[model samples]
Target: MEIDKVKDPATVKLHSQVEMGSMELKSILGYDDQGLVAAPEKKSSDEAPLKVLYSSGSGSFNRKVMRNTVVHSIRTVVFSSRLNLLMPFGPLAILVQTLTGHHGWVFLLSLLGIIPLAERLGYATEQLACYTGPTVGGLLNATFGNATELIISIYALRNGMIRVVQQSLLGSILSNMLLVLGCAFFAGGLVFSKRPQVFNKPTAAVNSGLLLMAVMGLLLPALLHTTHTELHFGKSALALSRFTSCIMLVAYASYLFFQLKSQRSLYVPVDEGEEIHSDASDDDEEVPEISKWESIIWLTILTAWISILSEYLVNAIEGASVALNIPVAFISVILLPIVGNAAEHAGAVMFAMKDKLDITLGVAIGSSTQISMFGIPFCVMVGWIMGVPMDLNFQLFETATLFITVLVVAFMLQEGTSNYFKGIMLILCYIIVAASFFVHIDPTAIQDKPPETKE
Candidate 1:
């Protein structure tokens, strides 16, 4: 078919627009003829109908494209919107458990309910970041990224659940390093096929070093605690822990300065194929920013809900543990961490599936690093303030587990490339750690000891 014979109103208008020197319309239509003469006609008999329709600027083509876009957007929302829709379950779980006094039911519902609520917190913080500019946005994201774990730990610590808090911290580190990272790699591998997912190797190396340092910071205190059990009032242990917390907090602050000010590029992930050129004139159109007030509102609502759900979760722990036949160590180390970081885990996996390995690594590995550097120490300090004795004195097994997890993860991420097998290996390591915690029952350990023996 010829352009003149096409007999479409939009196409005719498009042609007229092109004649009137509309470069945008011409570029969109891919129109060219002998160095800008008459528009080209269909040159191939095998041309697809939709392509031809689109090229002809037909109304059907616009409708079809609009329909496809709308459908895709709806699908994305439906899949992701499930979490927002289930937000009420957090409060409902609290209410039901309060009314019926069924700890098991309350625990289950709250656990399930908090997943979406936590995810929404991330969404809210991210939205808030868009308005706060990079520096403040980064701060907001950093502060609230682990709010779930912080809130849960604070509540547990207040309730005299020190063991639960300790185990949950350990679980959070292991889960992020092994389970979350592995899932990201596996999903990315499947998405990209045989090609290895690439990321900023130098940045990963620096993060690995920081993570190792954090693990050591945690390990040394635990080692000291193991050696000196006869100290009067355990004051020696508390002093050392407080000192380490102060040092760790200082280190965390320096890290913030480094990431946000001194060496920012070392922290930001730049994809291999991304264009580096910038158009200064188009700054406003380039970035998608949101409203600060709206983000704050969401943050408030979600945080309040998370607080309610966490309360229910904390209250039901003892009963849920006995009813489920799961040890406190397992619940704290495995279940709590998983639930706390559910939003991050989902985000990492989603990014991996999209082949955005750099972002995936940041979400998974960077988060684990934050947990080690910030969340754990924040809790320790909070416990100190409340006169609750929280320390980094993890059990021997936990120390060993953390050591191995950090070491193995560091090795795997050294190359800044990932595959399905690597992901599987990480997952297997996490499962092994989890199984060990489940089977290894310590009767004398305060944290492992339950209030009531199961019948």
Candidate 2:
């Protein structure tokens, strides 16, 4: 029994293991030559507890996979960028909550708007990368791009946030022309030392449509300001907005029809240099059918989340505006919209760096298309359901600025290839618009129509 007790587990396992003599064992055990000794056993309190890092007991393996994946560095950059872009929306909800009491929850409903928008943009981005003409598919993407911003405007309209709606509209148009396009042009110029090319005939048609719509965006307000007749449409009457936008809508639709009909010959031929040559010997086959369904499911799920998040963002934005005392209009129009388009902005910058000129151009121009085609219509329809009409008209000062920006962008995009000089001109055009807005030109002066514009 004395020998067996001494031969038990090592006293200090971490240190070197040693074979001890009987004398040492006797000393440690406090036993000698066939004598019994009472020895104290180690207590649980004296030992270090075991540490466990991973356990499968809590939840799904998929979540664990995601958690492990997040540790990689590259995904970290993209994720951080996306999150930074999304932060403004959370504050937006607080702003809404501040503006209204519990009624603010209704605004949360607008998140449903995020899905169609993302789907449209993702599709457009992919299509444009292939040097494809701005097809119906591409146009659909353009529509979605403006989705969240448009939805927020509708929600604000439902709440009778006239000032917010108009301001956000102003913000979207001006930001695209100035901040969005300006940033794109400037960055592309600096990074690649390349220029913005005009898209001649077909691209020109699209530019013309854009410029016309922008002008209409301004004219709606000017016409309303002067006529003072609130145009209504039955229970769902066409407001002054719809009538003015109708002209623009007709013009764009016609332009689209003409371009698509002649697309093969007119738009820079799609298959020129972009055709990829794949080797027959390569083992990678066309993707399996499961991949398609997976993409669709992911797309649907992501869209749903975006809409939910957008609703949260709109409310937070309203709350933040009240808290900050900054013009909610400015925040909605400029800051918030930018947050929503952070993905496109990143896409634009990446394409510029790689010098993918046509896709870069499409990203810039297509963004505006998304805002005009998708954003405006969505706002109008949603606003109506809520019983508050969204007006697209502008005062003379704003109208004039929009008119000028239109001419500049159109002229720049008239031919297909681009370089930095044209990009500078575009930036310069944006600067004039910014200055005019900053100065808050009197409505009277702009209405007076300086002799030059009148002639």
Candidate 3:
């Protein structure tokens, strides 16, 4: 009887089992899928060995697939080289959460998964940059790469986790300036230990100035609220925060204008020695060039998935925090920023590996600048619109940390030279900040009204 005509459940089951068994046998015998079906009917014992394509068309196609398989296999062997191999673990984490209602494990796995996804987002932005010029590319990467932090903060704000939102924002700044930049410098030093890594001094100076401007912007409100004690203090502080946010938005626009137009030359790389290669392509791998539209599509898809994962990650926050007995403020300030800016960490490291201090510096400084100039202000506006009304009056410790970070990084990069010890010193500063937060962060310091829920 023809298998196609078989309608009996027993017969269908038998056939399916037989087919699966045959496929399994072909797999055990070491034959390709195409050979499985074709071998029985057409392949002869004497037939010419399946010629591996070494040319264009079918041969090239087969070779490409073979090469990719071999490369991936090798990458698995070299764990440090192919961190993106962990990309598969992302979906696996989602599955784990779905199968077992364990928010703790889900949070852990999701955190692990987010690291590679964020890195890929940065990679996608780089591929997108090949098609779009520096201006658009920088904008795209900044908005999308930082999307993780922004989305996570928004979710936190909606849940009335105002402390997390504020802490995470400030933490991201420190992570970028201190942690990420520190790692970059360290990596650069490793590669070019004999010589100092030099980048565009002028560009670094401008970024430093802008970061200082943002630091001052944050400082004013903290100072005002601290110095003045009144019955309407909360209202005054809120009003001052909103006004500062508006001014920041304007300042951000001017920064963009400066980067894109008036001071664009400072950013343009002249030679390999002087140029900071914007992650146009992965130096270690043959990353396929993607179209602009496809890049956007993937960017959107990745950003959406990141949002979902972030929710799960954040949902488990309380559980994890309680289980670990860590302060919520510490998690928000240290761990959350690390999770959110995982891409920057990896990107900065990648450039540092290539000894491109300029790009490494750019990624670190650029990210902090964006968060200060754009992200904070945007979140403040969103909070107000949602009736949550987040303010910029960060804890004195947080404000002081920002000041120190900006001061130290600015001084370090002022001469456009970097060394291993410098990187170590910067990292030590971050470590000190993290340790302090772990010991003293008070989640209850900021009193925020709960976000209203719909009936």
Number of the top lDDT candidate: 3
- lDDT rank order: 3, 1, 2
Candidate 3 Cα misplacement greater than 4 A, ranges: 1-81, 95-100, 133-139, 270-294, 443-455
C-alpha RMSD values across all candidates:
12.0, 18.0, 17.6
**Please, what are the lDDT tens digits per residue for candidate 2 over residues 1-455?**
77766755455442334435656876665665656533332222223231112343435656776676545422333243343354344445445556764423423423323323443335334433333333432343344445556666766676676655665665566666555565665666676463332333466456557657666665756665666555542222246566655665666667677656755456543332223424442223222212333334443544555555665666555544444433344455555655566445555555544444445545556666655654565566566667665656555555666566667777666665555566666667656655545445333322222322434
Q: On TM-score, who's better, 2 or 3? A: 3
Q: What's model 2's TM-score?
A: 0.59
Q: How far out, in Å, is residue 174 in model 2? A: 2.5
Count the clashes in each prediction: 0, 36, 0
By TM-score, how accurate is candidate 3? Answer: 0.75
Candidate 1, residue 445: Cα displacement in angstroms equals: 5.5
Worst 10 residues of 1 by lDDT: 281-290
Alpha carbon lDDT of each predicted model: 0.73, 0.52, 0.76
Model 3, residue 408: displacement in angstroms?
A: 0.5
Residue ranges of candidate 2 with Cα displaced over 4 Å: 1-124, 127-137, 194-201, 227-240, 259-264, 269-299, 424-455
